[model samples]
Target: MRLLFLTNRANALRARISNTFTLPERFKGTVVEKWAKYWTGLVRDYKDVGVDVVKFGYNKPRKALVITGASLGLYACVKRNPDEEVFLQLLRQWNNKLILVSPTEQNVIAKEYVRDLELVLNRNTLRTLSLGFCTLLWVDLYSKDDCTYKAICEYTGVDYLKFYQYIIDIGFWNRYWRLDWKMRNFDINYL
Candidate 1:
């Protein structure tokens, strides 16, 4: 499966994915070794699991997209930041499946960001642009110790019960390495 990883910063999520899976030898030297060197670039022939890494500010085309630190991107775009166009373009091109990964703190920030954007743009335009992907999945990477279904509902705008159904909690990273397993088992039928 071809995977495109979109992040707000360099090596943030790529480092995690690299740690979880064993990349091929070519990628070991070019991508795995020089990951820090690239803010946005393609890692071709990433073993049997094809993977590409790109930062949010970069203007690159991708099919199936996995957005890590999605809340940060949303915040930037909503605030009319430097990369707003890039973010809009990325969202416009997202026709295939999309997975958005964010921590609790960022998710809250994104909720506020979206609220502000709603005031600036037409509701339909914002909704169609942001929530128009074929298969959109929101994955919460971090939750508070006392986090509950209601908390997630307030934070994500998803219904309390539907929040559990849609969001993929790979568990805390400190608990164990679960991203690889979840990613491997991810249903890519939309792709």
Candidate 2:
């Protein structure tokens, strides 16, 4: 079987392996070169195990696709809109296996991917709900700050009036947005 590995960042392979494995002192190079050598070694190992390895990025191959990265990379592949015909075509042709190797929990990744799928499947309704939630959060926290709201509106391309209407219609007063609860609790230095 053909094996293809996809990662959001090139260093993902190194990061994943470095946690449990030690590199030999003979493997001397810059960080990028070391990673490249490590990746090649991995491919060679797979080859010894009787798996046909396919190169990605340089030449596009029509075979089984292995995507190994952060959840965001998988999200991008699976979340393409119907209008993205070429992407859809490529997706359809491959037997795609996603390998998410990030610090984030698998369940969280799955949940977010599913949520994105839901948004794509029901674009109008889900998009409105998502935008409404974001808009409400921005309004609730930064209403007094003109620059923040202006930047938010500009970034999202959401009209202030429409967002207000959504909030009103959704009964913002009755519902808690939980913006603070969703904040990343862990320190970045730990990662």
Candidate 3:
């Protein structure tokens, strides 16, 4: 199945540890092996489930898309939209899905993103966009920050964290992973 995994790029706005220190400056005099390993671990998790994960660079298409950042990566994909059909095509899949594994902190741009998406994308399409290709809404989020998390809950009205707990209760991820993997083999237009 085709899957798109979008996460924060190191060059993203928050690349710096904070305003007080830049990313490079923060990592100065230290090896980045552990940092690399953390991302590698996320990739390995997908690999463990037999889903291929890409780093949001390069020009390749997967059967499913899994984006993890609420900042730039999410903004870029949403801005590109169905015109960037390669990604949109994957997003259009019945089992096509999106996941926002974002930091709790709010960025000004992200606030605007939520507003823009709500204004432009129709409820059905937004729900469909939230759902994968299966004619259902299937968006999910994993966040620890309360303010932004609360904002997401208010916007989607899904009580994301609670929903996630329920998913865990039902083993949702594993089942969805398998279902999506099977769904990935079909044509994008097959419906």
What's the count of clashing pairs in each model shown?
0, 0, 19
Kindly give the stretch of ten consecutive residues in candidate 3 with the minimal lDDT sum.
166-175
Let me know the TM-score candidate 3 reaches against the reference structure.
0.16
Off by over 4 Å in 2: 1-83, 87-107, 124-157, 160-191
Q: Report the error of model 1 at residue 166, Å.
A: 2.2
Question: What TM-score does structure 1 among the candidates reach?
Answer: 0.15
TM-score on alpha carbons, each prediction: 0.15, 0.16, 0.16
Q: Model 1: per-residue lDDT, tens digit, 56-169?
A: 224454422435456556555445422324434433332121233323323343333334433434322222112321212243323333265654565645455765554321
- Model 2 Cα lDDT, one tens digit per residue, 1-191: 12334433424664776676765566556686678777879875765454323344235443323344444554553353222233233223221222232335333533344344334434322222333212222223223233655546645555666765433212122232231222123112232
The models' CA-based lDDT, in order, is 0.37, 0.38, 0.38
Global local distance difference test of model 2? 0.38
Ranking by lDDT: 2, 3, 1
The list of candidate 1 runs beyond 4 A from truth reads: 1-156, 173-178, 183-191
